[model samples]
Target: MDSRSVSSRLRELVKFLGTVQGDLSNVTGPPSLLAPSSVVEVGHAWAQRPAVFAAPALESDPEKRSLLVLRWFLTSLRSQLYVNGAPGVSIKKPLNAFLGELFFASWTDEEHKATTQLVAEQVSHHPPITAMHIADREHGIRADGYARVEMTFNGAVNIRQVGHAMVHIDRYDEDHLVPLPDVKIRGFLGGCMYPEITGTYQIMSSAGFVTEIYFSGEGMISGKRNSFQARIYRREDTKRREPLYEATGIWSKGWTVKDVRTGDVLEVYDVEAPENAPMPIDIAPLDEQDEWESRRAWAGVLAGMASGDMRIVLAEKTKIEQAQRQLRAQEAAEGRKWEPLLFRSQEGEDHAVFHELTEGTGWRLFNERTKGVWKVDESKVVGAQSPYRGELTPLG
Candidate 1:
């Protein structure tokens, strides 16, 4: 374009941004910030720390493997909450994902000759359930899970995760069920909102070991942010329950795990350490990606978000939503039910394993809540391309 036109566009962009900020300034209640990402991409954060996610598969001892799993889970919280690239102390709300929205990514560890592939899909839209599957073929480790997020306003944005992830180690024939924690977004009125992991959750394993983590938010008087205490124990020892290992620290920063009997530190995970940084995820180029791919599907919205143009952002978002409504209407009119191409309802032996892992806990697979017990249909996931290639829908 000519210089005059370019200058005019820049001026308009600045003016629009100022106007947005001005509108926020006049708000009388808690204001929400627009995050520069979509919720579908948030599922990718679980596998960002690929090294941690894959470590459990390499360990032989079931106890040590359980500890490694706990470490991996705690380390992923920062990435999950800050996926928008915002400062640690600032978290904004992301765009809700449309049903069937898919994301594909992989992390390659050349030194270890390991590749961890991740696939995330928005399986349910009414309650917003995101299903994720991460597989490390080289290590025989596979994780499949879904997150059903329920957001409510109680002075702050309180979120309760109503789903669990199951990690299976093919070598040991073991399964680990990891429950999710609740979250509270504080400081909205102050204009800087941040997420705090709250409440308690547990990880139950088929190998007879379990780990429970308790999260404590910063108190008004004295306490640290992201602080937590976790205990690993044997499942059978309920009466004289003595923890095998304990972990304590701020999850957003770092934590140390120690042997309960000897008090010897086993491992330390530092969130900010250079060696502990999350591996970058590799995604296909937008042109090479399928129409249903997360980045390709939301290209326009992403561009608007990147350029800080709320007008374009809202318009693109509304267009997609309207298209989705139309597609649902068509399905109802034709008496055809829409099904996920990559994931299917959990059946057969999968049900038994899930039941065993969550036998005594409150983390049962809520098939009804998530629409269905979703699992990756490995047969359908052939390659980097999306499984679906028919007519374009809302996601496309």
Candidate 2:
């Protein structure tokens, strides 16, 4: 699509967003704006790509592996900055996920013969919180967490992503806690919508290493767009006068890592190269997936959208949504609550693990709007059929 056409589509999307904002005026929670695609599709957009997560599995050192995991966490931010779709399509709203909706996929590392599995579930619907668990069992690496987006409009849209993720290296008995960043949508008046992430997030490890990453946008005088710099230090160093490592780069493109004391360059991650590009996730066939699986649940709607039939898309989407609402109402009338199949809520004593890691960090690990902190049920996966069926496929 040409620039003019893109701008026109963006204008239309903005107008629709404005309508959604108006409708949500009396609502107390996050705004739900239905896009041309389902929330399941957009969830994949923010997921950690196969390449980034797979790289950490190749390393064995706790500290060095932790650093690579941090790199993957930073690189994952790039996914949130740009929308995925045909060329020139700037902003696309993501459909709200119904309660209990699930999205499952896997990423394979061909060279190492390793596979990383991802299981994401929409655990709550009112405030729309998503819980995701990723594991590379072969490498004894696992990450589990949940997040919810809270948006506000004041001329432009300001979105705050509230939640945290915990990465565990079972072999080393080490854990890394990472936080999400806030996003700002600009160019409302200019008729083009673009996202800028601005915030400072941290990656803290149980192995006594902490990395503080700062993100900033282009300034009128000196700074560049999507620029970020991170400093890694040991926990026991009270003075924090010296950093063990320093990383600098534009997040969307790449970053360079260097040792502070030795002044030796470690590694450079360039997303532009074919070899360094992210690998695609493999998913189960729609027919073979469970009824609640994202692809299976939204098959009709997605198929309609792909075929350019707006009537079919809207009708199918509305049917699914209406059915969900009816189910919720019936459950409410019967005084029963829906339970997630693959995850369980963490209550009082269960929060001990979260508190232990977040202590002194001044970070709220769980969003108050959510039902409760969530954790994956490992037993559910032990004998379960893998949701993904194929080899590593390159993502477009």
Highest lDDT, which number?
A: 1
Over 1-396, each residue of candidate 1 has an lDDT whose tens digit, in order, gives 465644554454334434443212111121124565667777566787667778898898999999988987887788787645434445556767777888889988676667789888888776677888899887899899887887655456567777778899999999998877888877544445578888888888889998989999788898898899999999999566689999999888889889999989987877888988778779998998877777887888788878878678778777887888888888789998767768877643457888877776656566667676778888778743543656665643
Give the runs in model 1 whose Cα sits over 4 Å from its true position: 1-32, 85-88, 347-350, 383-387
lDDT of 2 by residue, 1-396 (tens): 676865666666566556665323222221122344445444353344655565665677666776787777876665555654221234555666777777888877676566778788887777777888888777777788887767777666777766777888777777888777888777655555567777887788887777888889766697776788888888777375368888998887788999888999998888666776556768888778777777777778777767778678778777877787787777789998777768887763467666776678777755456667778998875645533323311110
Candidate 1 local accuracy as lDDT? Answer: 0.76
- Scored against the true structure, residue 251 in model 2 reaches a CA lDDT of 80
Task: Predict model 2's lDDT versus the native.
Answer: 0.69
What is the TM-score of candidate 1?
0.88
Task: Give the runs in model 2 whose Cα sits over 4 Å from its true position.
Answer: 20-37, 40-51, 54-60, 85-89, 220-222, 383-396
After TM-score superposition, what is the CA distance of residue 272 in candidate 2 from its true location, in Å? 1.9
| TM-scores of the models, in the order given | 0.88, 0.87
